[model samples]
Target: MVLGALGVCALVLGWRALDLQVLQHDFLARQGDLRNLRTEPLAAHRGVITDRANRPLAVSTPVTTLWANPREVLAAREQWVKLSNNPVLNSRTLSQRVEANAGREFIYLARHLAPEQAQQVLDLRVPGIYALTEYRRYYPAGEVTSHLVGFTNIDDVGQEGIELSMDNRLRGTPGRKKVVRDLHGRVIQDIAVLEEAHPGSNVTLSIDLRLQYLAYRELLAAVTRNRAAGGSAVVLDARTGEVLAMVNQPAYNPNNRSGVQTAALRNRAITDVFEPGSTIKPLTVAAALESGLVSVNSTVDTRPGTIRVANKTIRDHRNYGVIDITTVLTKSSNVGTTKLALAMEDHALPAFMEHFGLGTATGIPFPGESDGMLPIRSRWRDIETAALSYGYGVSVTALQLARAYAVIANGGIKVPLSLEKVDQPPQGERIISAEHASALVSMLETVISAEGTARRAKVPGYRVAGKTGTVHKLTAAGYADDRYVALFAGIAPAEDPRIVTVVVVDDPQGQDYYGGLVAAPVFGSIMAGVLRTLNIEPEQPVGTYAGVIDREGRL
Candidate 1:
């Protein structure tokens, strides 16, 4: 009976072994693989950002991030002390994190580590610790191009400027790969790639690095010299409407932003708006000229240099008995511009200003760009009409002002502004007759002459056409008596214009707050450098306008 019972047990055990090994082999293998296999991420390289000349503005560098399977790490608590020996990891903090997340599968140990440093930590061969190849963004131009190129977060995400605008094009898709790991959670075997990483496409901007540097340096100097709150400078290609250079003062370094102020991050050229002051005179005069209400030779009388409308008084610096329309712009006469606007149909001035791109966004892809305010009223007051004509009721950005001047520079055609390299000249909208535009350009040239408001804006070898603007900063209490925004907008080599630049010095302190005193020199200095850098031929003959004033006090 005992022999029979033992033989029965042996038979049952053999049958059970066969069932386990042969029938369930596939299921068991999959269960084991689940514990050892992982679908790891393959980080894709971000795109390069460059200037129109292919000079790198922003680039990415490879770095390593250390992570761990907390459960696996907690199992090997002895190794935690070993990790603490490395400067990057703290033993107490590591223990607390491991304990707090004891049930979890993963946690970050360290991030953005130098390859060499990460290698050192990995060489210790700590259990459950792993490294991932990641990227960190770097700006080569530093603060000089910070406001334009912008900066990315630690995870390589763009936050501002062109970086934010073109984030998708700059950020590539990360890939995936299946890998086998040991019991310690370290990658041990390379498996098959599930998806190939597609690196981001490179971006080429219209910004010229040379011109950007020039703009930054001169703008910084002007801001410091005038003790102004801040400033912006923009240079645009008249032919293509490409932003050759755009810069702002109080810039912050993108690479090291420890305590960067929020205000410093603004791309002021496109984002900030202010009353354009006398800078809008050219457009107002253009409106008058386009309306046929006044000829270029027509004159406005200003016996006392002050005009009153609706109990509001508009005054000029001094009295000029009677001046022609050209002289009106040359002197930046408030009385002259106010009279021109008052003579037009209420809708005519605002409609003409709209054609100049005022109170409208330039359609730049930049973030935080302001449309600026252009009030639309069903009925117009006499004072409101006067104020709008001289740029008080309306507001504009530096870029908007630049584009308006560019329209005049491009012979009354308005091209859409571009932040990227324009492959071909874009079709432009004809906003004004070329005849009137040319006449306006000729009249603007007088502003840089000796007797004009912006004589300091003159470039020695170029016939500059520009206007000076000095506006009291409007506050909640009304126009501030102490604060002023000084402005200069001009076209260089006026005979055949190539570039249009606008300079804004906000709230220049001290008695010298005039645009010609603070902003015009900045414009002249930057234009001189840009003309020489671009190899544009000098249009004015040597000594032609240098200290040579005609009998009529014109260059």
Candidate 2:
């Protein structure tokens, strides 16, 4: 009887063991996994941003973030107090602050800690406290490239400029893995990776750091010397349409954005639009030349320096009398440009302007890129036409003017502008006949001659072709008499144009506010340095480029 009883017990035990290990294996295994398994996030690093020459503009460095489970941390007040008063938290009062949020399931104690700092927190050995490995963006170029490179928020997310525009390419995708964990939420067993982490791909911009610094220095000086509100300068490769340099005044350091205003945050080169003044005259001249209304040598009578049209009077600085089309541009005669516009068929000037990439966004990859305003009326009146001719009715950003000039410098080919480095030059669309473009180039060249408005724009070793503009600021009460936007757009080595630059000085307060006096020198100085740095040979004799002019009374 004893042997039989023992046999029954052994048989019952064997059957129960089989039921748990094999018969009900699926359900039992799932129950075990639910209790011990967890999905963990695998951190990935953001890609570095570099210039065309691979110089670092923005990069990410390893950092640690301190997090705590409030429920668990409330029991370790002493350790919590110690951490709150630590230098890594940058606070002697954080202990009280943390107590206020004790009801939260999780809270951040400190963020962006150095490895050593994070280790010190770990040394506290508080329950439910943890450190997460993360990255913090660091901008080496700082304020110099702030407007272009932009910056990420404290959460490591992009908020402006290239960072915002290319967020997908700059931000890495976090991965996941399954792991066995202890009751305290610490990983105990390694498990299979659910997916591999995808790090962000690096970005290469067309910006030349050397040229960017040059533009930044010169623009800052111009703004300071003139006591102007602000300024912007753009340099573009005529051959490839690459933005070599873009700089703006009143810049802010992105690395530390304390007390920075939204006004200083704007990337003014592409976002801010203003009346281009006489800068649009070149496009108007191109339209007239293309419409068979005039040739490069055809003359317009600008006598008396002023004319009345449709209840408005457009005037030049002084009487230019009758002058050739080239001379009209050389003098930037508003009367002459108006006459050219009046000669064209209706919708001619605006149509040509649109084809030159005006009144539209340049399709650059940036946020808040503005498409400048153009008259939406089906037909423009005579005064409207005249104003548009001299760059008043229509508005444009500095980048648009640079690109428009680039079209002429590129022999009438309109290449799409780019902020990224292109391996090859983009195929361009012809906006005007090559012959007409050549004629326009010749006319533009004379604008830097002894008798023209921008004589100071002549580069010592390069044949510079450019125009100057001085437009009265348009206020809520109409055009302001005391404020002006001084502008200059020029091309270097006019024979074989390589680069086009545009400079805009806003609200110059000095006695000399004309574009030639204020903006042309900046253009000349920047282009001269650019040519020398690039080793571009001079197209003209050094002594042949000098000119003298009266500093006052310039249009």
Note the clash tally of each candidate.
0, 0
Query: Tens digit of lDDT per residue, candidate 2, span 131-150?
Result: 77788999998999999999
Q: lDDT for each of the candidates?
A: 0.89, 0.88
Give candidate 1 regions above 4 Å deviation.
1-28, 183-185, 540-555
Q: Cα miss at 548, model 2 (Å)?
A: 11
Provide the global lDDT of candidate 2 against the true structure. Answer: 0.88
Question: What does candidate 1's lDDT look like per residue over 343-401, in tens digits?
Answer: 99978998888888998999988899999888888988889989988889899999999
- Which number leads on lDDT? 1
Candidate 2, pairs of clashing residues? none
Superposition error at 350 for model 2 (Å) = 1.6
